[model samples]
Target: MTRTPEIAILGGGIGGLAAAAFLRRTGLPSTIYEQASELREIGAGLVMAPNVARLLRRLGVLEELAHHVVRLEIGWEFRRWQDGTVLSAENLAEACERLYGEHTYTARRSDLLAALRKSVPDDSVRLGKRCVAVIENGDRPALRFDDGEVAEADIVIGADGIHSVVRRVIADSIEATYSGLCAFRTLVPAEHAPEIARRNAHTLWLGPGHHLVHYPISAGKLINLVAIAPAGDYSVESWTARASIEEFLAEFDGWDPRLLDLIRAAETPGRWALLDRTPLRHWSRGPVTLLGDAAHPMFPFFGQGAAQAVEDAAVLAQCLAAQPDDPVNALQNYESLRIPRTTRLQEVSHGRSRINHLPDGPEQQARDKAFSDSDPLVDSAWIYEYDADTVPPFHIDTVAR
Candidate 1:
C-alpha cells in the first residue's frame, strides 16, 4: 500500500477477534466488522488444542480461558463400535506440553469468544455491518457493507468465513462439495451426561459409517456432543436448524448403548451439513486478503478448524509486524508462508473419517489393526507443534515456488 496500511478486518468470529487481539500485540491499529448485531458464540463447544492455548497465552488470555473452560488433562480415547476395545490412546496433556508447552483445553465457544472480544476495544468492532463485496485497486481496497456504507483500508482481510466475499474476489469460484454426512451437535449438562462417560477426555466411539465424539466444556457444567452420520441428502446447511433426536440415534442402532445415551441427553441438536472445499490457488489479491475459514476451511475430523484459524490470525499479525512499511509485500508473504501448510492440513482432514467410521466387517477389523502401529501423538506432530510466534526461513519454501 502507498501509505501505512490501515488494517480493516471483516468478521467478528473467533478468528477475527483473535486477529484483532494479535494485531494489538504488533502495535497495529485495526477494526473488525461483523454481520451480527451482538457479539456472542453461535456454536456450542470448541476444542482448544495445545497450539491454540499457547497462542492465547501469548495474547495474554490463558488464565481467562482456563477460568471458564474445562482443562482437559486426560488423553483422547479411540474405541471400537460393536465391541468396546481400546483402538488407540492419546496422552494429550503430556504430548502437548512436551511439544508446545501447554495443555489442550475443551471450552464452550462462548467463553473463548468472550475472552477474545474482551481483549479488543469495544468501539473497534462494528457489528451489524454486513459486507457485500470488496473492490480491489492498486494499493487500497474498499469494502461495501450491505447497509450501504462503504469503507476502505490499506489492507482488507476477509475473515468473514467459508462463504467469503474476498475469497470469491481472489480465487476462482470453487464449489463446496457436500460430504454426504450431517452432523448433529448439542451441549448437554455434564451432570446429566452418564456419570461414567463425563470425563475430561475426548471420547470417540467409531461405528459403521458414523461416529460419536463428546467432551467436557464450560468447566464441566456442560458437555458438548457431536454425532456424525451418513445422510442421503445434505441439501440444507445451517448451524441452528433443529434436528430430531430419534432420527439421529437411528444411525447408532448397532453401536454401543453408551453412544445412544449421549444422543438422548441432547434436547434438540442442530443439523449441520459437512461441506468440503478445494484448496484455493491464491488467498490474496493486491492488498486485500483472506483469513480463517475464508482462506482455508478444514473438515472437523482433525479438530483443528478453529485452531487453524487462530494460527492464521497470529501469523498474519507476525508478517505485518515483520514488514510494517510494505503492506503489499507482507500480504504476499502471508499467503506464501501459509498456503502449503493450510492446504496440506485441509487435504489431510478431508477424508480421514473413513478410518474412524469403518463399515462393520472384516475390512473394519483390518483397518483397526492397521492403526495399531500408528501413534496419534507422533502422527499428528506436524499439526500439534505448529507455532506462529516465530517465522522460519522458507520452511516449506512456497515463496520460491
Candidate 2:
C-alpha cells in the first residue's frame, strides 16, 4: 500500500490557511508555515463573490464569515464620476441565487483570515518560520527556513504571496510587473459617512484614469474604501506605506462632492503599488506545487483575487484526496484544471483596467452606454456560478502526457 503524503504549506495567508483547512477535512494533514510573528491580515476588505461564498460554506466557515460580512444584495453599481450618475448595475442577490445558488458578500480581510484560521487545527500552523528555499531530496523535498532549520515533507505547497520564495524552487525567476498604478485604502465609520454612502451597497465611481470602490464591511458598521489611480512619482510595492490625505484627495479633485467627502474623512490611508505576474505555464514539479498569488498573480480590477485563492485551495484538496497514491499526478491535475480558467481571468482583468480608466471619448461613452442597457450579471454568470466542489473529476490522462 502507498503511504499518504505528508504536506507542508508555506505561508499562513488566506490561501495557505484555506488549503490547510480543506486538506484536514479530507483526512490529510498539512502544516502551515507563516513568516509573520502572528497570523494576521494587514489588508482591508474584499468581496466574497457567490462562487467563493459557496466554497466557504462547504469549508465550514460561512457562518463565521457571515458574522463579519455585510451580505450584499445589489451587486455592483457603476457610476459616472462628475454627477454620480448610474452607468450600470448587477442584481447580486436575486440573479446570483437564481443562477449560482448563493449570495455574494464583502468582509474585512482580518475576519476572513480569522475564520479560515479557526477552521484549521491549532497545532497545524507554525508562525515566524520564513521559508527561504526548497531543495530536492530524493522523493521528498526539504524546506530551508530563515531560522536555520530545515524540514522535509512529501509535498510542499507554495501558498506564499506573489513574491513567493518557494516559486524559486520551481522556476529560476519571475518578474512581477507593475500596472503603473497605485491604490489608497482605508475604512470609514458608518456614523462619519454621508447618508448616501452609508447604504448597504457596493459602488464604483469611475473617471478619467481613476476609479473609487467602496462598500460596507464588518457587519455594516464600517465602510471599506479603495481609490485607484495612475502611480506617478510613487512606485513602492508594499501595502503598508502611508499616504498623505492631500495626495489622495488631489487625485479626485473637482469630482463628486460625496466621493470627495469620503476621501477627506479618511483618518489614515495606506497605499500600495499594483503589481501582477503573467500566468505561469506550469505550477508544479515533482513534489512541489504553487497556489494562489504564487501560482497566478492577477490585477485587482476583477475583485476576484482572494476568491480565486480560496478556490485554488478547494480544487487542490479535491485533487489530492482523489489521488492519494500519486501526489505527482495529483499536483499536475490541479495545475491543468486551474491554469486555463485563471489565465482567462487574468486577461479579462487587464482588459477591465483599460476600460475603467479610459479618457472621456467615444470608446468610454460606448462602454457606459452598454452597461446602462445590459445587466453585468449576464456577463459574469460563468464566474459567479463556478462551484469548485462540484467540478468534473480531473483526468490523469492529460497529466501523463
Weakest ten-residue segment in model 2 by summed lDDT: 392-401
What lDDT does model 1 reach? 0.81
- Which sections of candidate 1 miss by over 4 Å? 1-3, 393-401
Q: Which stretches of candidate 2 lie over 4 Å from their true place?
A: none
Any residue pairs clashing in model 2, and if so which?
none
In candidate 2, residue 348 scores what lDDT?
A: 97
Per-residue accuracy of model 2 over 203-313 as CA lDDT, tens digit each: 898999999999989998888999889998777887789899899999999899998888877769999888767778989988899999888888888899899999899
RMSD of 1: 2.2
TM-scores of all candidate predictions against the true structure:
0.95, 0.97
Q: Report the number of the highest-TM-score candidate.
A: 2
lDDT of each: 0.81, 0.87
Q: How do the residues 24-122 of candidate 1 rate in per-residue lDDT, one tens digit apiece?
A: 888887999999989876788888877788898877777777678877766557788876687877777677687667788888888889888888998
CA lDDT, candidate 2, residue 121:
89
Deviation (Å) of 168 in candidate 2:
1.0
